[model samples]
Target: MLNTHLIMEQIRYHPIVATISIAVGTVLASEVIWKVVQYFRSKREKANRVHEVVVFNELGEICAAQHLWNTRPGSQEPEAAHCRNTHCTLRNVGKIAEQIDRAVYSIDLAIYTFTSFSLADALKRALQRDVSIRIISDGEMVFSSGSQITMLARLGVPVRVPITTYMMHNKFCIIDGVERVEEIRQLRKRKWMRPCYSIAVSGSVNWTRQGLGGNWENCIITADEKLTAMFQAEFNRMWKAFEKTEASLIQPK
Candidate 1:
């Protein structure tokens, strides 16, 4: 049988045993301290992290003016006055434009009816900054009045339209660093990793005046790697299927 009392007495008196016990205790305390530090660091990082999913709504007093103008007979004057001050303040459109403005690498836009000049200007600025942009629009809608597709194409930005008669009514945009996102996804296949700074914006908010400002619409902006990758794949597939011949030519005004 082990002499537990005797061993304790030796440990209590022996300098070597006391030093070893203190060293072990110090190591254990250090490990616990390190673990506590890591836990708080992780918690802080999570607290300071940006939102993965952001939602924008096109409703309320902003759209109410347009609604009043359309529904009531004598409300046009007041509505017009309200609209004159508020028409340029569409938050959803501003958000979309902000995404365009922030593009460091690329922007792939697949919109149905793109008549918003502000958005078109945003694309132009991105083009000027050498950010690669590809636009795919509805074939018929590309020729519609107020459509900025032709103007964009004329500025040397690549634009394409589906050859099919059915409307290409997809309203989504894949923005920034898609290649980095793909690289991170491939890394995740082997081990866990953080998502890259790629963004995919989708929903009913078209790149049009009425869609962004007047209509009831919703937009979702996500930094989810998987979802963004899926959108990137869809955009690539549509880009391949769309006819680029009309997009390359400068249309006559």
Candidate 2:
């Protein structure tokens, strides 16, 4: 307490000491501020990367993909045995249609928004090959502008919509193939082709152009028989609610 005079004398003469003290204080403050900013930035980035369930209220201008939703930006199509968790981009969307194109006995599917012409074309080919097919979509979005639901309905593929106060936000497709060699031969004899395997796909992705070609989406495809059957059963149950013979020009025998 009695050294005030001495302390003042030392600080006044050692100006370099004062400068160094000020510089160290500034660096420490800057470091703290940088750390705080980095913490917040990391939180914001993680939130942005996380996918949340979106409740689509109305159909916007349906167009090509303008956003990306892949967790891995440049990942490739999943390998066969490993496709159980396959994530897909816009270009990989055609594979879904291709799977439908390969359907042997039937293609049962439901989607929230049906806007992919490529998928509609695949269904068209399935119909031409006499494959039993049914589609269910959201009552609101299915009839909206640019949705290919009408195109599919006009082409005589069975299409149904559940009238609900809430959104029928579901998307899945199951491809049923011949389970037996005799069934495969029987279909082949009729000029119909069956995929060597059966598959079912389900995920956050819709069949819309925005879902596949523009927005962030993810889906998993599997050859698991039990899983495929479960999905098929769900489709059949939903199909009955709005089924009509006029829904298909070619009645399923």
Candidate 3:
């Protein structure tokens, strides 16, 4: 009987140790759960940063479209599969002009060489619609067979080209002027309210038909606001500079 009583006492004391072990285990488990929650929260925040808000229907459905490009057949071979395909992001000048409505308030371009009749036609259409147009290109492009500048001027498009010593090596366009205006004002009130996203179209093709549809060129469309701002500033600066200068009128070729 005495031995049995002593064994019971030991067993009773063991309960306290068991309780402590359980308590420690619960604390460890809670810590692990806390860490897991933190990891998920961080992931969600990062995802939000990269995601874009897109409107589908009248309701808001957030979506992200990364900058991508595609090339037409037979001009230059692509570096990889992503470099050439419909899945890539690209819009011809014609497509871009078609996309513009309401007001094609501004067109900022810095092409090294442009001789595309299709592209010229697109610009002309945009001007006829009373959409404000602006163009700035190097002197090399001024020699196109078709008098693009004169035609644009006849249609009242604001064309500006600088006679700087350095090459005007920019090749990009912004279709909407509202966003450019908003960005320039540094007005945060409309920061979230952007005009339809602008695309950056580029490729091996010049404005010539051979370059636009004939040659394979890589271009990407992005809703990237930062790139938009940069291009806007560049265009505005060049426009202002050219605005200060007196330009000799070119006779229609």
lDDT of each: 0.71, 0.65, 0.53
lDDT for residue 184 in candidate 1, whole number 0-100: 39
Regions more than 4 Å wrong, model 1: 1-89, 180-196, 243-253
Model 1 C-alpha lDDT per residue in residues 140-160, reported as the tens digit of each score:
888789989888877777778
All candidates: TM-score: 0.61, 0.55, 0.51
Candidate of highest TM-score: 1
The sequence of per-residue lDDT tens digits that candidate 3 reaches over residues 1-253 is: 4497765675588977757766898999999999999899877744433212211121111111222123345643222233223322223342444444323344666566666554666776666765556677765565556646556656665566667677766666666644564553364454454333454443333554444444445444443567666667777787788774326444333
lDDT for 81 in candidate 2 is 27
Superposition TM-score, candidate 1 onto the true structure: 0.61
Off by over 4 Å in 3: 1-94, 100-104, 178-197, 202-204, 214-216, 249-253
Clashing pairs in 1: none
Model 2 misplaced stretches (Cα beyond 4 Å): 1-90, 177-196, 243-253
Clashing pairs in 2: 65-213, 65-214, 66-214, 69-216
Candidate 3 residue 173 Cα shift, in angstroms, is 0.9
